[model samples]
Target: MTLLDLTAPPSRSDRLTALPVAIVGAGPVGLAAAAHLVERGIDVVILEAGPDAASSVRAWGHTRLFSPWRHVVDPAAVRLLETTGWTLPDADRAPTGAELVESYLLPLARLEAIASRLRTGIRVTDISREGMDRTRTRGRAAAPFVLRTQTADGAIGEVTARAVIDASGTWHSPNPLTSSGLELLGLTDVADLVTAPLPDVLGRDRARFAGRHTTVVGAGHSAANTLLALVELSRSAPGTRVTWMIRNASAIRLSSSTEDELSDRAKLGGRVEQAVAAGEVDLVDGFEIIRARRDGDRVVVVGSRRGEVVEHPTDLVVNATGFRPDLSMLREIRLDLDEIVEAPRRLAPLIDPNVHTCGTVEPHGFRELTHPEPGFFVVGMKSYGRAPTFLLATGYEQVRSVTAWLSGDLASASTVALTLPATGVCSTDIGGAGCC
Candidate 1:
């Protein structure tokens, strides 16, 4: 009897065209890519690690988005949804993460085109060119890509495709405490106390922070949202205190300027600034956390502020310090990433928050997103690496361009149609979590 050896090298013909493009996420960006691929008459498959599409977005579903429906919807995805008679939300009104998922993402995923090709509860553990490892260069571009996967049931599986697009976002890999970007000391000791970056403060997670001292670390919109929510909680719960911590001495608040394009973002920023000014939140700037240790049931955050060591006590800590990409799965694939930002080498400078913000960054397409590997590309927020401020519009445009290239339409792939208008305070969001 003949038996198949899954571990054996390729030992197979390369009918690359017969295979589908494997998208490594089911979030907005990943589904958008699938929509574009279907419209282009290309075969595609979507692999989502979660049980539901946009699970990451759902995790922060309660947070309101600063972007309205117009900027939030992907053109191709809308077209696909329209065929099914889906009604779009008001173009001018912003939506919360839950609203976007229920109104847009869930419907898009339910569409026959996406639903038939989508696979859920399956996690891609690692990926590499089939047959040959990264060391081999000969005829590597034509080989089908192999993905080692694990089912939610703990069963291992394998999936092969002609190309792979990783839209898997950085939501799962939240940034840890500590100034140097390492996991905070004694984090495990108070694991139960560190809440998710954006908890349902006004909703289900209310009891966790309702009448307690909550210290939120980070300077992004995630922190701001929580701070403001805590203020609201304080009014009702009484004794519900708030604290905002930042590594930089000066906080970069959203511009409330009328000239800013995204007015909602400005309003969010302004609200945070107002909350701090009103002393509704204890603002601790230049505070770099070194450790988090348990004190009774509460946690004490130890840090250094201007060469002086300090300890801040809190009933709970929210590490909204921002997220970083997880590159562990793609180690076998060759990636040309920027040293600092960790974005694709060529695209790093364009999105760097230190130099570029809002509409100032140039419109980029396939050329900027391509990596050393022929058929592999990383799109969505994960592509931004350590850099913050990724707008949903930017990701929609990315998938459009990537799918165009994948379908062999170089003309459309190179064309950059989207640009951020001058109006802006904060830069980006996922269906409107403000920027970041």
Candidate 2:
């Protein structure tokens, strides 16, 4: 099937233009990369999984990002907007997902940087090296990187490019509920409870949970945002009781700016510290969920905190733990992965939480993951290396590093050797074990 024509095909002169860099996903990071490549005289073809920009924002369309508009907009994208005489929004004002999507993402996609090369409703199912073993292909050898995609029409095809960048974002692959110690509350798999094209909340189903005990799990901004939304839902729907189950006794909330550490303290303090101040939400800290079961109409949750174990009853449960890169599609490929972060860890000492490696290390214990596949780069929150910070500033740095590496504009890839700290067990304490 043919992909939807978001824009007309490039003319003969345009076709003779530079081979477009293939960018996956249309999130802030991907859009930013496209703008950057365009400035460098490189054409770009963006493969976005969503129907359009801001579909993810619309997922929780009603929720506001803890980070302000300035923090989320990519610099390259900003430059393009400036070129078009578009004034940037105030950085201080908190922007909701809907507002961000409508005011920025949608407009950018509709603009020149995106209009011609954008392909919405197309999901990149796989990527791998592709080239003719013998010969007979246009322009040098086959690019070695073939992107397999499925369009909305159910048509399947492939596109080859000189380089590939994965900016698929993180929300698509949510951390498994069981991984966080929460069981399928009612012998019902989390999948069954989840509806495709999942919306953040159910207005009609809102009454069902009224006055019923509901639990929200996780310690990140996403969870915090969800909790905040539920708090508002409980104000008028007072019967809806809310409880937050976090592995860390305290929730770690992030703000837009890091101008001063204290500034972050106030913002994080506002939503997390102050929000908890209200007695409406119960905060269960210092606990890891161990099991979940359906107790008639309610679900029972078991967990351990500090040195003690406890149980709680709830009518509904959501595990907002987090997500990692779904590189499993490339499992057949033998690629070098970081022992620490387990991602294709780059040997560079770059600090970009928008990267997948950062998010992977938090749960999996790996550092920046990298591979020898030249001209290939992956960016965005998925690259956060397990220590998912979910910050746009980190994403900016990621694009900068990736673009430099891809274009061969950097002097050399950065590197540093790290020694693991002692684990308390002495060499003598072990049975003739050697210590490094």
Candidate 3:
């Protein structure tokens, strides 16, 4: 099948060509997919849940990304931007999430080729083949996809497309507070006391942590960033106290400064280590939280360490335990997902955090991202499922290959090419895995 066949008369393989390809989520990867398809003169449309591009990244705008400009910027996107007189940032300089949106995503969305095809504030609630549900597979490939969407104004509507790329990342669905992956007791009553991952402590959200005793849980880079920020807040507001909680016996996994390949990432780890060593931040190791409830204005966190029960009281809690993909909307779609990783079955092994680091995962393209549902793909962080090893660069490579395959360029789709920075140390516990 070729691009030309898509628009041909009602042939066995050309029925789908009547509709444009639809991409869910206007984040970096989704936008890149649009750029690639547009370059090929293929019809494409982008559906974004938020009012603007990269809204999720904007929430963490205060945090600086460890990867430099060169690593985060997509090659295809750069080509499009260059034509509009866009000046690239310093290749070696690391940018905060805000810079990433303003300097790259926003500009990309405004491009003449992409801007006209983009639609914001349109959330995709469900997707399936037109005139056919999951059970009916006969002649499914020829049918266009039906996307159910909810608009910002509360109106619901449907859009049809020849293909779909779901880049709706995991940012909206965060993991629970309990260590066992179940909801903690009394969690509901203290919902307001719990903050999302990547709160801007030193900026807009500073007042929330200024004079309060904050407890931060999890062992990933998100947790590390929060701990560092709280320590900085303590200097200006001496009454503010910060506690770092982890399920591990030791925090050795938190520091890879000396040998880290990325200097910015190393610096973050170094700063976190210094805070712990200076006694500026309380370290609660081996703590497995089981319950949290409101105690007047404060929250009482109860858990166990070893065989002993431990309780801690704090004014606020930041659950930086990472996020999981929202798979509910995809129930009607045929998918072959990994039982554990929740990623595409074929791609799970390559990105399994148990055996691979960010840089070690081999290059993959359309083949790994494709699902049992033809003309459907889940790219970007959502494709990683529960794994914390997804980088912006890796996502770019994924969409690049996916677009090539959709355009019937099988040879280009199979030719994998990507390079990522090593974590320096190997075999860190799953919770401590890091990525861009």
Which candidate achieves the best TM-score against the true structure?
1
- What would the per-residue lDDT of candidate 2 be over residues 127-192, giving only the tens digit for each residue? 765643212234322345678899989999898776677787656666555444333444453333
Model 2 — TM-score against the truth? 0.74
The clash number for model 3 is: 0
| Backbone clash count, each prediction separately | 9, 41, 0
Instruction: State the TM-score for model 1.
Output: 0.93
**Candidate 1 ranges with C-alpha deviation above 4 Å:** 1-14, 257-259, 419-436
Candidate 3 lDDT over residue span 168-258, tens digit each: 8888888888889898899899999999887889999998899889999877778888888898899999799999998888654455656
What's the TM-score of every candidate structure?
A: 0.93, 0.74, 0.93
Selected candidate, larger TM-score, 1 vs 3: 1
- Candidate 3 differs from the real structure by a C-alpha RMSD in angstroms, to one decimal, of 4.1
lDDT of the candidates, in the order given:
0.81, 0.56, 0.80
